[model samples]
Target: MAKYTEEEIRNFKKITCKIAGDYLGVSSMAVSIGMRNDLLPIGFAIKKDDDRYSESWSYHIVDERLIAYKHGKINELQIQNIEKNLNTIIEQFEEMKKDLLFILSEDVD
Candidate 1:
C-alpha cells in the first residue's frame, strides 16, 4: 500500500549513485543518469527448471522519471521481505515442478 514520491526516489537514486561511484570507482553521474534515464536493471526474479533453479533478481523499479514504490521499497526490512518472498516463490516452483513431466522437458532415465 505504501508508495514512493518522485522526489524521494530521485533522492535515493542520487544516494545510490554516490555510493556506487565511491566503491566501484565509476562516475556518480553514470549511476545518477542511469536512474534518471530508466537505464537501470532493477527487476528481480527467480527462474526454475527441472535440473536446477535459477535466480534472477531485480528491484521493483519505477520509471526513472515517474518513480514508484510498493510495500518493499521503503526500508531495509521491507526489502529483505520482498527478496524472501521472491525466493520463496522460486522454492515453491521447484517443489511443484519436481515430479511434473513437463518440468523435466526430457527424461534422463
Candidate 2:
C-alpha cells in the first residue's frame, strides 16, 4: 500500500471538493455545512458517473492528518496506526466486498 503524505492528503481534499462542487452540483461550503451538522455522513464528498453508477473517490478527514477513502470502512485501530505514521492504515485499504452504496447513497438517492 502507498502511504500518502500530509500534503498529498490536503491536495486530495481540495480536488475532492472541487469535483463535488463543480461536477457533483454541490458547493464546497454546502459540503462543509453538511459535515458540521453531521450531514455529510463520513465527510465524504464525491463525483459519480450516473450512467455507470460508479464513484471516482470519496473521503472524509477524520482528523488533521487522516482520511477515510471510498468503498471501505475505516477502523479505529487503523486510524491510530495512521496517526503513528504507519503508512498503511489497515490490512486492506480498499475492499471490494462491502457495498458503500447502501450506506452512503442515502444522501443522494
Candidate 3:
C-alpha cells in the first residue's frame, strides 16, 4: 500500500467504518463485521500501537469505492440493504450535521 504524508492525510476526505455504516444505513458494528469477514473492501488499515490503553486502528476506504457504492456499483445484497435502509442513513446524516454544528459552536478560549 502507498503511504501518505501527514499533510496528504490532512487533505484527504477519509471516512471511518462508523461513518461508512451511517452512509450505508447500518450499524458501525455491522460494517466492522463485514470488513472482518471480507464482505467489504478496505483500501487500507492504519494501526497506532503506541496508545497506552489499547491499540488504535483506522480503516480507510477509497473515495472511489464509496462513490461506486453510492452509484450502485456494489453487490446486489448491499444495494438491496442500502435501499431498504435509506431512511436510517438520512437520519444519521442529519444527526451528524447537528453534532458538527454543536461542536463548532463551542467557545474555544
Candidate 4:
C-alpha cells in the first residue's frame, strides 16, 4: 500500500476500476478482477450499502494498486480473469464507470 496524507486520500473523490484503468492504461476489467481476487487493494472508498447492484458506493485508489498492476504484480489467475473480449470488456467497463459515478453523486445535492 502507498502512504497517503489525509487530504490526499480525500482528494481522490472519484477513483474506480475504470479510472484506475485509465491511470494505468489498462482495461477496467483488469482492475475489477484484481480487486475481486484480492490481488490488489480494494481502494479507499467503499460502498455504504450492501447492494452492489445499486448505485451506492465510493472509491479512491490511494495505494500502489494501479502501479502494481502496470508493473506486472498480478498473477496468472488475475491475468486470465481480465482477458475478456475487448469489445465486451470496454462496453461493460463504461457502464460500470457510469454507475459508479452515479453512486458517488447520489448524496450530493
Which candidate ranks first by TM-score, i.e. highest? Answer: 3
TM-score of each: 0.34, 0.26, 0.42, 0.36
Residue pairs with colliding backbones in model 4 are none
Provide C-alpha RMSD values for all models, in order.
Answer: 12.7, 17.3, 17.2, 17.1
lDDT of each: 0.47, 0.46, 0.64, 0.60
lDDT of 2: 0.46
For model 2, the run of ten residues with the poorest summed lDDT: 62-71
Evaluation by lDDT, superior candidate among 1 and 4: 4
Worst 10 residues of 4 by lDDT: 1-10
**How far in Å is the alpha carbon of 88 misplaced in model 1?**
0.7
**Top model number, lDDT:** 3
Over 1-109, each residue of candidate 4 has an lDDT whose tens digit, in order, gives 2343434434676666676766665677777666655566534435567776765545556444455545677654654555446667899999999999999899685
lDDT of 3 by residue, 4-109 (tens): 3334433557666766666666777777777655577534456677898996766766655555664567764765576569978899999999998888889453
Q: How close is candidate 1 to the true structure, as a TM-score?
A: 0.34
Clashes of 4: 0
How well does candidate 1 score on lDDT at residue 12?
A: 63
- Could you give me the TM-score of model 3 versus the true structure? 0.42
For every model in order, what is the number of clashing pairs?
7, 0, 0, 0
